[model samples]
Target: MYLLELYQNNYSKDLVLFETLEEGREFVAQIPGYTLETEDGFDVEYVNPKYLPDYMEIVFNGNIVPLSRFSFNSEENVDIIWKEISNLSVKNDKVIEGYSKIDAYVVNNDEVKAYVEAREANYRKAKDFIERCGYEADRSFFGSEDGEAILYRKCGAEDWHFLCHLDPLFVEIEDVEEYVKEALEEAF
Candidate 1:
C-alpha cells in the first residue's frame, strides 16, 4: 500500500495508505480538507533502479544519515540501527557514522540494488534532469515511470519540499499506479 500523507494545520501530520494516486485523490476529495501531492515534470522517468549508489539515506529519529564516506559495509546485508549510532564516533573531517534506523527486513535486496544503480546513473546528469524539471524541485523526490526517487534540491523554494516516504520501515519500490488499477471492476 502507498502512503498518503496529510499536513493538517495545528495538528499532527497524518498518513493514510492507498494503492494508487487516483484512489488517494478520491479519498482526499472526500475529506473536508486534505492535500494530495503528485510528481510532475521530467525529461525521462525511470521506473526501476538501474545502478547502485555509494550510499543510501535512511531516516532515523527524524534524521537522514550514515552519510557518504562512512564504512558502508558492502559486505552484504549488515543490519544496523542507524539513529542508535550516528554520533558514536568522529575522526577529523572523516568522522565515522552508522545506520540510524533502516529495517533490513523491509528492504528488498533486489529493489535496493536496482534503486541504487538508477540513482547513480542519474547522478552524472542530475543537472540536466533539474533543468528539464524547470528547476522546480519543491519535492525532493518524484514518482517516475521507474519508481520513487530522492530529489535533492539545491535550494528549497517550492511547495511540498520533500519526499514523504522512506520511513523507518523502508519498503522497496512499488508500482502504485498499477496496483490501484488492478482493483477496478471490468466495464463489460
Candidate 2:
C-alpha cells in the first residue's frame, strides 16, 4: 500500500495519484512523460512537497517494490563475479569496456526478443538461464535516485537480502574465464 504521485503533464502540472507503485508505473507506460532522473527509467514526483520533508518526492521506475517480497541472491552473484574478475587480474580498462557493452545492450531500443538473442549469443547462455541464475533480478522500476540501488530483503528477516542489478556484468568472458569458473564453483 505505497503511495505514488504521477505527473501527466509537467508543463501543466497535471497529476494522478496511485495507491500502489504498479498502478503508477502502468500509467506512465501508457502515457509518455518527462522524468527527473535516469536510474529507474523514469522519475515520478510528489504533487505535494510537504509530505516528505528534506527528501525530494520521486519514484525510481525500476525499484518500487519491497525487496523482501522477492527471493534472489543478486548480491552474492555480483560479489562472485567481482571476485572472479578480481582474481583474473582483469585490467580496469577491460572491465569498463565490458560493462559498457552490457550497458549498451540494456539501453538499446530494439525488440526484447532480439536483444535476448543477441545477449544470449554473446554470453553463450540462454536469457532464461541468466534470469534463473539470479542475474536478471526482478525489479519494480518505480521511476528516484535514492531508491535506485535497493537490495531485496526477506520479509521479517533482516539478514537475508540481495541486490537487483547483478545480471549481464556478472558473467565472465574471455580473459576472465578462470575467475568466472571459480565464482560459479562457489556459487553452486
The lDDT leader among the candidates is 1
Worst 10 residues of 2 by lDDT: 76-85
Error of 2 at 13 (Å): 13
* Weakest ten-residue segment in model 1 by summed lDDT: 43-52
Tens digits of lDDT, candidate 1, 4-53: 43222223223444545455455434322122334475222111112225
lDDT of 2 by residue, 41-140 (tens): 8443322222222322234455443212012222221000010012235434432211222332343323444545544443443223334444442333
RMSD of 1: 24.2
What TM-score would every model get versus the actual structure? 0.21, 0.22
Best by TM-score: 2
Clashes of 2: 14
- Model 2, residue 89: what's the lDDT? 52
Question: What lDDT does candidate 1 reach at residue 103?
Answer: 25
